[model samples]
Target: MMRRERLRTSESPDGRKVATWRLVRSGARILRVQDRADASPAYRWPGREPLPLGAPGLVLFDELAPPDLATVREAFPGCLDLWNAVREDFWHALLDTSDLPASGTKG
Candidate 1:
């Protein structure tokens, strides 16, 4: 099992909401940290709000399930080295933590 902790939540320099999370697998000293953006400014259509980038450890869009390793690899084909270091369990846990609703949000 892994533990997920929210390290910080704040607005990015461009004003998009952003957050950081810490992931730790049980009985392991390795600490994995990931950052998430609520939306991506680089890929938004004109006259529309930006959507989540959905990249590994990068953009975590609300209303979307955590992406799988294959998806991350496909999105960032150049980041072989980085993806190699990610564990499947950790990735799932990381995004699962992010998928949680805001403190006061209701279904």
Candidate 2:
């Protein structure tokens, strides 16, 4: 069976952290990209089990040292819009690949 892993990273400018749920199959390919938009920096993971489907994955802030949500919102009010565009771009790219199986089963 395949397993899922959660990878977290913070972006600059508005130091809001983003979490991505990835699944690594038997090979080195990435399988899934689940975004969490409400995760906090204080949350800790055991690195043993997969994150729940409804768990928070990403956090948006303005600073790394002391995240300022208001600042983030002020600076990047369209962040969610941009994020959604990027996600769509990625999905389209994956679908454009010819190597993907005919059954539409991606791995």
Candidate 3:
């Protein structure tokens, strides 16, 4: 299975943080890091706001499942490379987007 997950984060010039994720394909119960990108943190929670991690090596995702184009678009609207990566790399069979809302709208 291939997973697109947070790898690391960096502080932007303005003191805000930018998170980056990598696409990893795992076969034997192991995850190997692949492609990566830094994107705006626009993923949401129903009632809680996203906060900075209190420690290192912590992980969070906008969606627990494979990220849909809309979710990515919300965070990084003009990123063509990110669009292509989500379109081509993530294995849809491993994803269940039925529980997700339609793309381009808020949760």
Candidate 4:
């Protein structure tokens, strides 16, 4: 089976970056564009597993750090619909988890 991996980056309070290469074994709902968004356009496999939290890791950025829809779309075409769907899902999920009504509906 072809192994799929995802890159996750987090910054510490200080001016340091830590990158993690997560082994995304399987997830049907996980969007493919997420991979493009997390890593640079010329991303390549690091040839090894990520280091521990205390250890250093390589940090990579997409074409744009905080990519806008246009940037993301430009990087990977035909992702507009997918992006919108994911955004809507996240919005609704946030509302549901926060126990908030769906705007027009009263709880």
Superposed by TM-score, candidate 2 places the C-alpha of residue 20 at a distance from the truth, in angstroms, of 2.5
| Ranking of all candidate structures by their TM-score, best first | 1, 3, 4, 2
After superposition, which runs of candidate 4 have C-alpha atoms over 4 Å from their true positions?
1-64, 93-107
The lDDT leader among the candidates is 1
lDDT of 4 by residue, 12-84 (tens): 2232322222223221122123232333333322223332431223322332223433343455454455545
TM-score of 1: 0.31
State how far residue 49 of model 1 sits from its true place (Å).
Answer: 5.5
- Tens-place lDDT per residue, model 2, 34-101, is 23454523222222234444345533221223222233334445555434443443344434535445
Whole-model alpha-carbon lDDT for candidate 2: 0.34
**Model 1 Cα lDDT, one tens digit per residue, 1-107:** 21244332332344332333234332111222233432333322122343455443444422223334455457545544444445443455656755556689762
Local accuracy of candidate 3 as per-residue lDDT tens digits, 1-107: 21233242232234333334443343111111112233433223332354464233222444445343455446445454444444443444226455355689655
Range of the 10 consecutive residues with the lowest summed lDDT in candidate 4: 23-32
Higher-scoring candidate on lDDT, 1 or 4: 1
Would you list the clashing residue pairs of candidate 1? none
Which pairs clash in the backbone of model 2?
Answer: 16-61, 36-57, 36-58
Compute each candidate's TM-score over C-alphas: 0.31, 0.24, 0.29, 0.27
